[model samples]
Target: MTPITEVEGRRLPLSNLDKVLYPATGTTKGELLHYYAITAGVLLPHLHLRPVSFLRYPDGPDGQLFFTKNPPPGTPDWVMTAPVPRSDDPSARQVVIQDLPSLMWAANLVVEFHTPQWRSDAPAVADRLVFDLDPGSPATVVECCRVALRLRERLAEDGLVAYVKTSGAKGLHLLVPLVPTPSEEVSAYARRLAVEAEAELPSLVVHRMAKKLRPGKVFVDHSQNAAAKTTATPYTLRARRTPAVSTPVTWEEVEACTDPGQLVFLLEDVAPRVGMYGDLLAPLFDTRGAGSLP
Candidate 1:
């Protein structure tokens, strides 16, 4: 018989508890679940009312990976879902994890949690803008850090406060909170900023998506601000060889980062960091105080 666990009055049958999900570190599914449970206080706020897309590595990081926007077949009746109208299909529905039990249910199957810039209730409006600073081969997170610092300054000049985070891979992500604005406008503004950054730092920045142009430069990926695009949600574990989380970082940490390894945060480091820093990206939730696009 499958062992059942009760989380906040919701009974969930968890499978393969000891199954290794991060082969390099030997991190198991049980540990991943624990990480989600512990960080729920901070993680849930960002996910609240947002439709999530799951990146699943059922057999571990080395196995086949797939992306699913809709809830899986066995998803419980109590799990909340919201309709997301697609250009091809209007009846499509996506899972919304509004509470602890719902999070755990998703965590059991998902290695990475991805969400759009807008919430479920207002899918056409963006509440934040994001720039994914991806460093190319010879360049590393160190290069991304330099680019992020410069971008932060640029956003500041425009009266927008930007927050930095690790991508849980090799780069960094910078986010700017915004008052509700149309997704197209947000995407346009982000694109404009990317172009400006490329012009200002022609030697270090590339705004275009072509991989050939990325070597020795940080690609300022502003296309994630699009309505259909999604970013790896903060606090979500990446499906790398090891269990590193997409973690929020202080500008001080970003500034002090000299080695790429310094920005890599594992699952074990998150809860303690949350205890000490209490959600560095908390300001993103203040929708009323969010800055308007200039």
Candidate 2:
């Protein structure tokens, strides 16, 4: 067992450093923590002011896993938590990630994935709209690129700028930074875009959420735009077989991606990619809406 360490003024009691999460890659818990530590600079900005939901793998990735909204018991008081009101009970408090130390604390819990809401606390406003492209089997990521390109064109017609990334699984995520829009307005706008996409490419894209109907097509899930709804934060590790990361990529790469593997980044790739792209999603954090069209 490795001893607990301090990071960003927070004490993290980390253990089981050698526990393997990705069976195929043999990626260990310590490696995961180190990855987060090294990439914290780029990753923290996206996580800042957002409530984070965790996908925990206690034993390992292949072992029993659970999703958690509240911080687990024994969470240090130093880990900043947001008192987000729950949907079922507006009075119920849901803890969200506040800073780098809090995020590192989550890494100690073996949080394999970090999913954050679209809005931040300082403004409690939605700064971006997300379009989640969930593809059913036989559709593949190649199909997602085709669909995303079409959606990008549609958004451009409305004078909106768009960016994209692999979901780090079987899909893709498209984001459009907005000028502090209401949650409902963002949701409505995303829904409208999804509908337009489906109407334009009936065979390639579908806006319906039903899994039964999504086969051979990309399901444009605009619902993630709603308050409290989350999409995996960029650079978050996916609890997949090979340690795939939710990575940001350029539209040119999306179009050039022949297979999803080309975009499936891992722990080692984080630094280089961050250096190359320099926080590709930074526009989402710019409240001035510099890139958004007037």
Candidate 3:
């Protein structure tokens, strides 16, 4: 493992990643960091950056291993390294979010910034939504990507947007950021939306939740559409074998693939290929004031 990167008063553990390769596309924790720094560098011109969380694991004899979503501050130019963890090995895992404040220092691009037009006074439609998809299953991920993309398009057409992030463990999250609407109402609206979506895309997707019913398709799981329900934050470094950073991507990317191979990425990777930033899906939270429905 590598030594800690010294900051103002505290020394932050930076690298000595404890991850196994993902085969042909397998990447080292170090490579992941590089990917992030490169990506963050691209966004230095836009977006408001935030703190990072770090997921650490020990690399057996190698000592502590780690990865990150947000790396600790003063990361020594961003080398991928993690504090050693306690376990055999995680096929995948959560690393960390660090040096949060510094993320703003690196902001440069925007994906869907509309702060100028945002109006909080508008009636709160459905705020705070979570779309829980499956992660362990590649088929589920693709199925989910399809459902989410369709939702994004529909929402966009309706003048609403949704902020998307991965579930980090098994699925993707399509968070419709509303201005704090009641949870039940939001959940109700979500159910309605799900019904409509399922009706429209019955051949490719389904909203049914019973395991016996899911077969091989994705479930919208509108159950997550309830209030007081918070989805895992995007790019949150989690605990696991290989640390998968939750990220937001383009609608096209979501539509083209369902492979976990294409799903997760380092926090650094989110902004680069994007060449922009902003919660494109932020508008979905605004509700139409329709009371909760059965």
Candidate 4:
């Protein structure tokens, strides 16, 4: 019989507690549940009302992985969901993790939580802008940091404040809060910034997605601003050889980082860091005070 637990008055059947989800670090299913439960306070704020796309790795990182925007077949009826319109197909009802029970319910099966810049209620408007800085081989995250610093200064000049976070992989993500704007307009503005970054730091940055040009440069991916695209939600665990988290960081930390290893944050490091610094990306929630595109 599967072990049953009660969370926020909801009955949940948690199984495979001993199954290893991260082979290299030996992280198990139960540990992942605990991580999400403890971080729910800080994590739920970022996910509230946003339509999430789950990236599941049921058998672990080394096994098959899949992405699903719609709720899985057996999803409990109590879990909140919202209808998200699509350009090509009929609207799909996507999962919305607005509270602890809903969050833990999804976390039990998902390794990565991805959400668009707009919330489910206002699907046509973008509430934030994202820049995914990916470094090519020989150029690691240290070089990406150098580029992020320059981009930060540029955004400041435009009256926008940018917050930094680790992609939980090899690069950095810079997000800027915005007063509600059309997604198309936001994407255009982001592309302009990417172009400016490339021109200003040609030797270190590349705006286009050409693999050949990325050998020793940092690719500034601004396409995630599209209404149909999604970015990994902050504090969400990434599927990798080990348990790493898409953790938020301060600009001071970005400025001080020189080694690639310095930015790598495992699941164990997140709760303590949040306890010390609070949510560094908390400013992203101030939609009313956010700046407009110049």
lDDT of all predictions, in order shown? 0.92, 0.80, 0.48, 0.92
Provide the TM-score for each candidate, comma-separated. Answer: 0.98, 0.93, 0.53, 0.98
RMSD from true fold, candidate 2: 2.0
lDDT of 3: 0.48
Clashes of each: 0, 0, 66, 0
Q: 220, model 1: CA deviation in Å?
A: 0.4
User: Could you give the candidate ranking by lDDT, starting with the highest?
Assistant: 1, 4, 2, 3
- lDDT per residue for candidate 3 within 111-180, as digits (tens), equals 1111101122222234345666652232567777877888877766655556566666566777655555
Report the C-alpha lDDT of model 1 over 161-225, residue by residue, as the tens digit.
99989999889999999999999999999999999999999999999999999999999999999
| Residue 17 error, candidate 3, Å | 4.8
Give the least accurate 10-residue stretch of model 1, judged by summed lDDT: 104-113
Cα lDDT tens digits, model 2, 40-80, are 88888777777777888777768888988776888877777
Q: Model 1 off-target regions past 4 Å?
A: none
The parts of candidate 4 lying over 4 Å away from their true place are none
Worst 10 residues of 3 by lDDT: 108-117
